[model samples]
Target: MDHAPRAPRRPAAPGSPPGGDERVRGAHPHAEPGAESDPDRAGGFPRPRRLPERQTVRDQVLGALRGALLSGELCPGAVYSAPALAERFGVSATPVREAMQLLAREGAVEAMPNKGFRVAERSSRDMAELAEVRALLEVPVVLRMARTLPAARWEQLRPLADATVAAAAQGDRAVYAESDRAFHRALLELSGNRQLVAVADELHRRAQWPVTEDHGCARPGAAPARGTSARLVTDATQHAALLEALAGGDLAAVESLVRGHVCGT
Candidate 1:
């Protein structure tokens, strides 16, 4: 009796390594142990990974919303519903609402009755006033630190300052804002005043609110328009200069740089 012919083997997927059995096994031969296998990897249609639930989702959504706000993707004075934002983020509405509530507390957005949260619309006067307040609070403290903070301590902050410059060069407003804030916070921490650092950080966040076309402020003696890549790079480079001033104990330069950095002068 003649035996039935053996079935032909399935062909290897395109881009697969020669002699590899990844298509049959549903995973790469060199894949990490315990890594999830993609059933459709050979077809180039890998499934999307689900976000973690609860606090992780809430924190991630909050960070994403904050980035959007800083990058001007979430426009000022516009309302965004929690359900809509949740859909956009591929998360449940519960976490989106929680994140929006936190933003409301931070004064980044305000809740509307029976509606969604509205992005805070801060005027030019508001930004100028916040900047003046920040200058009043920060300049003197930084000047004091300049005289006493050790060079090594100031040197430690160079990375944060460099991060701001890199972010500015890339024109990523969100990353630049965060790096700038981290640099200032690290600088102020040398003053040994936790309360001052906290207050100054809040002021910095408020001052960073995106200004609409009708409410823009031009920096004194700066040729580039506000929020432009040139303006951001100019602002970012000051962090390194300020660190150098602090390290060298140049009180006048420290004071002037701090004031100009905060007040946009």
Candidate 2:
């Protein structure tokens, strides 16, 4: 299906931006500095409540849980209870249960008959399917962007590219994952397809969830390779090269690199 034309995406000029949802949770295992937590206060990586009206307890619980999943605080096999998560976040079990159900719907968590919930486990086939979907959705959009989007727009993504490199160098999985996500998102947003962005984000998140076992990248697991820190450094370099290809309007190179990145990463 063909779409109407719109302005190409303009990446941030230089400085770093928030690492998507990671920034929302503050991404640290501990609470933010000076942030207070009480059993009744309801906190744990939740976004700040606005003054006039605070976020609903359910939203707060959801945000914190999502952050936990992304930050590796919640592992694939870890089983957790609503009451326990509620106590830890200082929220009510009602909200925690509601949030867990939501995550379950997204396949981020699973419900046990007696146990509350466990992080969802992915098989090698599961990860492969996610990568295949991501490639189908993202590669074409990026190819179009490369051919039509102005070169200046691509230059704005330099900071995100740099952040990916730094995060890989530092071996910070959370940072690397989020930075890589951000870079791809920035590219897709240029295509002005909201549905595409939403679907791509879902696949990206699933692909990123860490597996408890050591699974080869080519097999079915998609969390960066087992010794992925070094691999991430190599991948980060490839991101820089991809940006150069996009800027140069090399359609063939853009498509080739995007395929390798979406499928192989």
Tens digit per residue, CA lDDT, model 1, 111-166 = 99889999898878888999889988888777777777688998998889989988
Residues 1-265, candidate 2: write the lDDT tens digits.
9989988755543433634223333334456554445443334455657779679989988877876676556667778899988988997899999999999988889998778898877777777788888888888888877778899998998889998999888675666777888988887788898898888887887787655464332222333333367877998888899989999988898888888887775
lDDT of each: 0.81, 0.77
> Residue 171 error for model 2, in Å?
2.4
Lowest lDDT block of 10, candidate 2: 215-224
- In terms of TM-score, how similar is model 1 to the real structure? 0.73
What total of clashing residue pairs does each candidate reach? Answer: 0, 1
- Please identify model 2 stretches exceeding 4 Å from their true place: 1-60, 70-72, 215-228
What residue pairs are clashing in model 2? 124-220
Predict model 1's lDDT versus the native. Answer: 0.81
Poorly placed runs, candidate 1 (over 4 Å): 1-55, 214-227
| Best lDDT among the predictions, by candidate number | 1
